[model samples]
Target: MEKRFNKIVTLFAGLGLLVSCVSENKIEETFGVKKLVDNCVEKTILTINGLTDADSLPRNILQGQAEWNKVGIHDWTSGFWPGILWYAYEASGDSTILSNARKFTEPLYGVLDVPVDNHDLGFMLNCSFGNGYRLTKDSAYHDFLLVAADSLATLFNPKVGTILSWPAMGEKMGWPHNTIIDNMINLELLFWASKNGGSHDLYDMAVRHAETCMNTLVRPDYTIYHVAVFDTINGHFIKGVTHQGYSDNSMWTRGQGWGIYGYTMVYRETGNEKFLDLAEKLADKFIERLPEDGIPYWDFDCPSIPNAPKDASAAAVAASAMLELSTFMKSEELTTKYKDAAVSLLTRLSSDDYSSKDKNKAMLMHSTGHYPNGSEIDASIIYADYYYIEALTRLKKINEGRRL
Candidate 1:
């Protein structure tokens, strides 16, 4: 009897060991996330401080060979650096990171006064002041963002029932009333503003904009166009064109990702069933087109498929969106599908092909910013790093029984 008991005990102990190994392997898979985020933060501080010390306005560090190339404050990409700093502070609780965040954030005060011509005010003010308000709860940040929302509302036209994306370039060039799929990402700021005592009209405008895009921009299969032009005078449909896509009818990977993220946010803000439906459709299409590794080429329609340059930024954005999307799902199957896809993308991005450890003065690599313009191609983009860290933070929160 004693011998039999010993054998059973040994078998149970071995099973326990197997369970522990499985748990540890899962941890091992994600262990690089913290180390990667920390390394990226350290390199970002050095690069931003060095640039600001040299009397620079502080913007995106696109690429660094011997020296870094940065955009100006007026450039659309300017707001992401401060956002990166805020994420660093949230992850580390380091006061020095907060100081740098403030320094970089103040430069965006001028953006509120600049005339609204594009769908980037949310990208500008919300990234800097939006995160600032959330972290610090400072009234100044709130006031600035409220005014920025008002500035954005200036471009909304009741006739067109959507906010204008491209400025009135010229009659001969067409596109007097153009709204791109990218504009969907900007509505979060409008929703936040209205809820926080800004304007009800702003909320209405956002809903109308989403409706207009849903009507024209999204195809039946959930593939999206880069740009859609309409008759400004009467809200008549003009034509759809490709500004930064493979063709006029192809899916621009980043743009489709934006659609998913944007519609997910709209559903969150409004509890509208239609917005949720749209988000789920876009999410399904995006998941269908993802490469086996989950990262995507700049455009899904690119002929080079296996050899195409991957855009880590799009994956980062999509993963973040999927994590949020899982919370709104009703079915266990869909929740698992979206959440697992997010984890897979995050895992691949943290690998050597994408993750960097201060190697080239950037965090996430292999991000293609604008394939059509041949600008910032195959480099580390600041926004890519921002969203990657944001997704990691979201996952950490989920593990700890919290929300981001």
Candidate 2:
């Protein structure tokens, strides 16, 4: 009887040891991964600060004939930098940052009214005008948004049931037949148009564009192609091709993020079941591929890119999108799963490794702007900064409930 009792005690002790080991492993996986990402964010912020001067303008802007050299030019990319700055300001309530952002955006008002032949009008005007309206509630911002919407509406093609990418350039590419995954961002203008301008046509066009993208651009597995060529004359799918990714069938991480977020936005605007379903499917695929660190590579399918670096920007964007999708999910299991994943990613970004306490760069690390083209790989991109702050903001709101 004594021997038997001793054997049972030993068995219970071993089981408890195993459970403790597993628990420690899980905690390390969560916190350890976040530490690396946080370091990246710190470095990025430091770098951005180094690039700027006392006036809060980038030192590069002081150079002659650079894109940032001009004060009032309609720079499509400027909005992202200021947007991130605004986000940082809002997060910390730092008055100096807010003042600098206003200074940066005030000069660009001239070009916001000018019609440009770019697909990034939403990235440009939406960040500036939308933020302006949200902050000041000024009618001028609303007016600018309307003008942008008008320009964007002209890009819509009824045949393809989507927006024409950009003006046909040197090549024989059909204007109305061209669509890209990035057009997801452009759809926000349509949503604003419908809400502010009372244009049902814009909303209908946005919905159809999303549907066309779903039918033509997205794969059965939820991975996305960068661009799809359609028949301008007859609304027929022509061919799917990759513009910036490794190959036509390759899964670009940022493109997947765009699909995830875009579909979620579509669901929000229209309450469409199909959009929500697609968003969930894409989220599933994304979460499955995350590394132990929670950050993703620039392209999931191209795991063998020689010397290719990880893209922190893509991870940040996907994290923000996942947070948005979490709100719409009915399953608490899924909500907790996605919300935790997003929080993990954001926590990593906010850690000392990813973020700089000195505020030199104003970004978090691991941004790859372009790898195949050998441009801006593993560098700090303005949009990456913006999306990272957006992810942080969303995470804060989620944690604080509706108070934020």
Candidate 3:
């Protein structure tokens, strides 16, 4: 659901948000919160129980495939499956879910046992063990997350002021120092560790990486480049390009979502107004480009319009970011604006067009994963389901006057 080319003004004029044409929107309605979350999660468990275990993690399933395309512990997405389980346990308090989550989580220790090869340790460990520690307060999980943070820190290039997203591939791709916008989300693991027991250098490294991304990756209008190439020689800017987006110039919807979520979280952890400002700007740009449905297409600038694959995964990511962002706004109007936007997104995601419902064992569908590679086109991706459940849980808590 991207704003089609050249129709931006007309679309805004003819159509208003679900909240209204202007002013704050009401958020107290009973939108079947418990039923929706429970059913989606129940379907998730039923669908995944048979496919996933400590041995393999489900990534995505294409149409006509009877089973999900599974991966081993080395897969970057492995932690999301367990992270989803931890969120499920937090929401339902189901002991079975808890047991299954632990079953899937313990095997990931191999990540810390090896030298970090990629910038996804945060995704691999934090999503799984980080949430586990937050929910269960398991001392082992806490200790593991601290090690994960240190491992992730080893990837930081002090010269570039950003973590190397793909260390092994950088040499082959001729990008000596490359940082993807998705790297922003991983900073949370470092932030958490610095406050817990790790050195404050972890926190400093995260902020530096974010600052590098803010300067190099974010475009003038705040639409993000999927990847930014930095000069390794002097740690100077080289050029902005894309590997997963439509082109070197187009706005990747998911990249923008990562920036939004990243900076909001940075602000939350650091109490920095500059980060909050950047988060607000990123959110505004995202909202400006969103189509009527609030979900975004794979790329806002993709030549294809109605035919471009919709990334429900991007919507889930932004929805969760906005919910937390709304809490930090000083202006009542802006806070209402974000929370209302989040509600609109969640409502649409719950609808038949997006929600897998009885059709599949996943929570949501129609996610565009690596469209340029023609991989997992319009499939149910694991990260989509992970962030979708996380957003739903956050909404449920917010509605009940509980802390997110």
Candidate 4:
């Protein structure tokens, strides 16, 4: 009887060890997150080393070296570089990455000194200070972000029922009140502020903006317009058009990715079924239209299908959003479908086809920033790396059964 008991105990112990080994791998080796994370850490250091000024943030890498987003140089993308560091720190558990993240993050405090006339503050601060606050639990970061949230709310025209995306650009284009699809990304900041310590009205404002966009921005086919214009006095949507898209009728991949991520986050924050439904719809439309490799062209209607520049940035955001969205699915089939789609995107991006391992310091390549403006075409964009790391981290958290 003693011998039989010992044998059973040994069997159970072996099973426990197997489970531990599996659990230790936050991502499956087949998925390549572990390798990619190490690469991300190394590349992040390389990116910082290339920078000469602390105030200038790394933005893109088109070829041999890195580019920057400065005070006036595509400053909307400023937050992503620091955001990448934070995510990299979380993945690698390296204190050096933490210090680097804080170093790049503090310089953005200068953003508060200037007037907040544009909606990009959310893109600028939330990705940097917002992640910092979440990870460090620093009250100062929270307070700074609250001020930014308040500043963002100032642009919300109750008349238009949406946060104005471009205040100065509206003047340039003769738009009374213009709201772009990218404004959807900013709603997360408002939602986070409402739950943390700021006014609950911030939550309400986010919901209102989302609902308004749902009604005007999304078209009948479910592909959305890039920009929606509203009459400032009457508070009615005037027309939908394109600024960065191939045409007024074409769906821009990155804008669609923002809508997918924004609605997914709004659903998480509000528990509203409508937002979930919309996110699912947007996600479905995006997934069905993707190319064979799952990375999207800059525009679905670009007139050059097989040859159009792929937007790895779009793929990164969609994968991250879908991973989170998968947890919210009510059905197992829905969950699997979304997760599989996300995995397909991540796998392709993690593969040699997209990884910028030997080519450049950036994690992934071939992202389209603004094709119509002829900017950052087929380049290594900073935000793409940020979201790619974030998606991998989300995969890790999901494996650990932790909250995202």
TM-score of every candidate: 0.89, 0.80, 0.91, 0.95
Global fold similarity of model 2 (TM-score): 0.80
Candidate 1 on 352-388: residue-level lDDT in tens?
A: 8887765666668888888888877778787888788
lDDT of each: 0.82, 0.71, 0.87, 0.87
**In candidate 2, what are the lDDT values of residues 46-135, reduced to their tens digit?**
444444432233312211222222112454565766565566555555576667656665655665455666677787778766776776
Better of 2 and 3 by lDDT: 3
Q: Sorted on lDDT, highest at the top, how do the candidates line up?
A: 4, 3, 1, 2
Order of the predicted models by TM-score, top scorer first: 4, 3, 1, 2
**Deviation in Å, model 1, residue 277 alpha carbon:** 1.5
Candidate 3 has which clashing residue pairs, if any?
1-297
Candidate 4 has which clashing residue pairs, if any? none
Q: How accurate is candidate 1 locally (lDDT)?
A: 0.82
RMSD of each: 5.2, 9.5, 11.2, 2.0
Clashing pairs in 1: none
Query: What is candidate 3's lDDT per residue for 183-202, written digit by digit as tens?
Result: 99999999999999999999
How far out, in Å, is residue 155 in model 4? 0.4
